[model samples]
Target: MRRADRLFQIVQYLRGGRLVTAHMLAERLEVSDRTIYRDIADLQSTGVPIDGEAGVGYILREGFDLPPLMFTRDEIVALVAGARMVRAYGGPAMARAAEEALVKISAVLPDTERARIDRTEIHMPLWVVSEEERRTIDTLERAVEARHVLKIDYRDEAGASSCRDIRPLGLWFWGKVWTVVGWCELRGDFRAFRIDRIASITCDGRVFKHERGKQLADFYRQMERDEAARDWAHRRSQNAP
Candidate 1:
């Protein structure tokens, strides 16, 4: 964590109106108690309404609004890398928005920070992902964010085709490919749809509520169980042979 980001997190941690101890803050930020002490003093000197004793804890004064965003060098690097990845995989509209946002971030930052951003060497190559694939990712991202049900014409590896109304939950990138995980109304189960395999997609316009077993956490739990079962089967097969 950068000093600037650490300071911002301190404010956020303190904002919940509790006396958070130095040890707690240091532990959360993966820094030393001495560092937290110094950071607190620096923040107070800058007129931030942070009040506390050394051993007891610190709390932010009520009615104090957070100042503008600040980033340390490492945080800026992370931000830029993330934005670049979005540009690499998130398609044209998203790429344009990310670029514009980076421009705005650069404008607000000091020359030192801007220079750091310019000098940063992190890069992701966009080699084989086409404009159409990126557009599909963009469309799926919009659907997930908006909680829109998607009606998709899909094809599997055997060239079997199916149409399904999918309650979009999340989108994931697997290096060379992109996947959208969702609740498939037809199968009555969660399914992972490769965006590349989706023949066509349209809005279903039905805003169905996410039931208890149909959320992302549920999907993760199911995946874990499947992996565990596969491992168990492999071990049993070895013992049998």
Candidate 2:
């Protein structure tokens, strides 16, 4: 999370008109208490009207009204439906995190006003992510965050097996499949390996330097090049036939 956003979130937590400790803020934001202390100091420096010491809990001063977040019934329904979709499709960790946010949103709403969210009428199909796939997604996410090199055993559509060392860069979920994009040491270029095709993956405990051509921006460029090449090839094949 960006520092500015984290600082705003701390204000929201304090707006409950209750004493919130720096440790509690740190836990909620997934940052160190020292970092929270620094953020609080930064907010106070800007005259945010937060009250308390580092050890004691802090509360927002009275009469500091944030413009109310006025949401209609339709908007609340959308938020509820979106949260349900995230819970159903996003990974387990993300699902729980999204639910926590929904709970926070519900906390301030009245019972009648919150009923639209409760009865959204949107139904999710009975589908679940398998253990293997879930683990692969989680592992790839961690690898990307840590910039760890991963050793993976992968099988292609033709059932040919190959081992690769990939500098984990990004992971994308496309409803049904998870794709892990990375710089392949063996290929000497960028590659997108399907999570399901990966028989095994292990973090090699080797962190990679931030190389220019291996960044996410470079990967996007490679994707554009691949799309253009496919279009040219398809046009040529049509002309030939």
Candidate 3:
């Protein structure tokens, strides 16, 4: 990294509320302890308030923020790339937020830097979930966050339809799609519902008793194991001589 880029990185790292030691910064930036100390001094000269104690390492002054120019070329490229990727695949709210953030970032930078970013566009393929499914997933997310029970009309893979009152524990994303992991009042068990398969949803306006020790990751793992077992059995039956 160039000296100026490394210096900016030092300031950004400190502004993130980390107690950075000379040795740690040296290893991270692939520089010597002397170089780290010099960069620290340069940042201090540029009005970055950094505090260092004997044993506790170095910290930036509370509320000390990095200047907009701190972003290196590569850092700006990465930010633009990530923002573009999110805008392409994420939901409407996320796409709009990423667009707003990119706009603000460009508005703050110099015209030259802004032109450089504009010239180097990053592109990614967009996800193709239906608008109806996207709206259903959005509604379920709100209900989960608000701790509200949901009354939903859902259909299963076997074409069985059911009306369910569920206390949503969390939303799980699997295979690039969304599902609701919740306690089903009708079945009296925890169930996972594909948001796309939901025919209708009504917020009951009653908060749920959150499940104990239930994590979305754990539920996904269990679902994966079950699917694997089913696939294995099907293969075994097909291969029987």
Candidate 3 whole-model C-alpha lDDT, 0 to 1? 0.78
Clashes of 2: 0
Q: Model 1: per-residue lDDT, tens digit, 1-241?
A: 6789799888889987889999999999999999999999999999999988899899999999754457898999998998888888787888998998898788768766787778878888886578888888888888887889889999998989999999999988898888899999999999999888999999957676778999999999999999999999999999995
List model 3 lDDT by residue over 50-118, tens digit each. Answer: 989434579988886545555778988998988886565555676787889889788778776887678
Better of 1 and 2 by lDDT: 1
Candidate 2 is scored at a TM of 0.75
**TM-score list, all predictions:** 0.68, 0.75, 0.54
For candidate 2, the lDDT comes to 0.84
Q: State in Å the error of residue 71, model 2.
A: 3.6
- Considering summed lDDT, which 10 consecutive residues are worst modelled in model 2? 123-132
Please report how far candidate 3 places residue 93 from its true position, in Å: 2.5
Lowest lDDT 10-mer window, candidate 1?
Answer: 64-73
Question: What order do candidates take by lDDT, descending?
Answer: 1, 2, 3
Identify the leading candidate in terms of TM-score: 2
The CA lDDT at 225 in model 3 is 88
Per-model RMSD to reference:
10.8, 4.0, 10.8
